[model samples]
Target: MEIPRRLPSQLPLILYLFFIILHTNVATTDTIKVGDWKEILNDTLVQDLGMYAVLRYNNSTGSNLSFYAVFEAQAQTVAGLNFRLALQALDADFPRLYKAYVWEKPWENFKNLTSFEPVLG
Candidate 1:
């Protein structure tokens, strides 16, 4: 079989691009405990500024979350659930997500798609 003359020249560029993509996605997740949170949450959020209005306390579930560790875990779990929910909501834009929902082959890298739906709720 005859090979294209340009194939050899493009090989290095292809390999370079592959390595660039691989290295760019290599990120480490750091888990910070609630006790160490004083440093992280210091004056960053709006709530840190002033004394907010008194929130009504309704003691329903026994999980008071008085211990910050419990609060952190609950917060992380809610955030993770919200992320998955957002992903599912994205699928809803395509077609009947409630009917024949599709679980696609997930990609490691992020993708961009645009959709618009009028807000009713």
Candidate 2:
């Protein structure tokens, strides 16, 4: 029996679809939550490696009292990528009530102060 060959025009489309399907299946959909913040901080390995750090703020006396936590992760390599991914997941899952900013330094040296600033009426 003779075999039929695919035309060159169809190869690109086929490959594109294959990749789309493969990527969709492998894509991570997990998101981080408020509780996960504690876990990330308590991780000794991450701390020792200097891969991640966090800054926390609490207001005891104020009309608009709130607790703010900024999580920082050093993204120098593949592990850093994971750290960033986890951070993003947390942001997506925990929808910050107060202004929250995520930074990747030294590219993003300054915090996004605009979010913290109160909007003037």
Candidate 3:
């Protein structure tokens, strides 16, 4: 069998490129898949978080908003867990839609309202 003179020189470059491609794909896959939001079926925890979000917002803004019901919820895990909720509330006797982001560390008994904003049409 005859060996090509350039084969040895090209082998290292091919292996190096293959490894680089593999590493790049693994990293991208991890980053994209980590912390994906998942739907939460209605439960006690979801209800509590929904109420907590409204209560915190009302307290901070001094707005007389009352917690009504949570329409939908999703959760994501990060350093802590994040609760995203679409909830209904009463503002001056009219129902309104709200989006709330709550971050909670259950082990530490720590919870914070990250964002609360009314959803517009």
Candidate 4:
């Protein structure tokens, strides 16, 4: 007697099992952590009036990064002095992000003029 061959339904089941195994193997493999904001910003373009600094940390579970920037301009007269500061935060993949900008008014006794969301370049 001849043996019966597997039906088309078996093909989908076999493919599903193969994908499950492949995904499991990929998930179990060790993942290297890339957490260095200083290095990341070293290659970035710096603005003429702005200076930037970054701090980063990571562990086996996850990572966090923060960036700070201070922009200053000198004015010969009281009207020309202006200051702007920007701060940003991001995750390892940079999917989740936050940014803030602050303006300083020294004429008004060096008080914070306003705070707003920074526009991304």
What TM-score would you give candidate 1 relative to the actual structure? 0.24
Residue pair clashes in candidate 4: none
- Model 2 error, position 34 (Å): 20
User: Sorted by lDDT, highest first, which candidate order results?
Assistant: 3, 4, 2, 1
Name the candidate that leads on TM-score. Answer: 3
- Report residue 8 deviation for candidate 4 (angstroms): 2.1
What TM-score would each prediction reach against the true structure?
Answer: 0.24, 0.21, 0.72, 0.24
**Regions of candidate 2 where Cα sits further than 4 Å from its true position:** 1-3, 7-13, 29-41, 45-121
lDDT of 3 by residue, 1-121 (tens): 9866997899999999999999999877733233999888889889989999999999999999989999899988887889899999999999999999999998998999999999999
Worst 10-residue lDDT window for candidate 4 reads 35-44
Enumerate residue pairs that collide in model 1.
none
Assess the local accuracy of residue 72 in candidate 1 as a C-alpha lDDT between 0 and 100: 13
Each prediction's RMSD to truth:
19.0, 12.0, 5.4, 19.3
Kindly list the per-residue Cα lDDT of model 1 for residues 1-121, writing each as its tens digit: 9866997899999999999887777544355443232122323221211111001111232212121110111111221111111111122233111111111122433211122122233
Ten residues in a row with the worst lDDT in model 1? 49-58
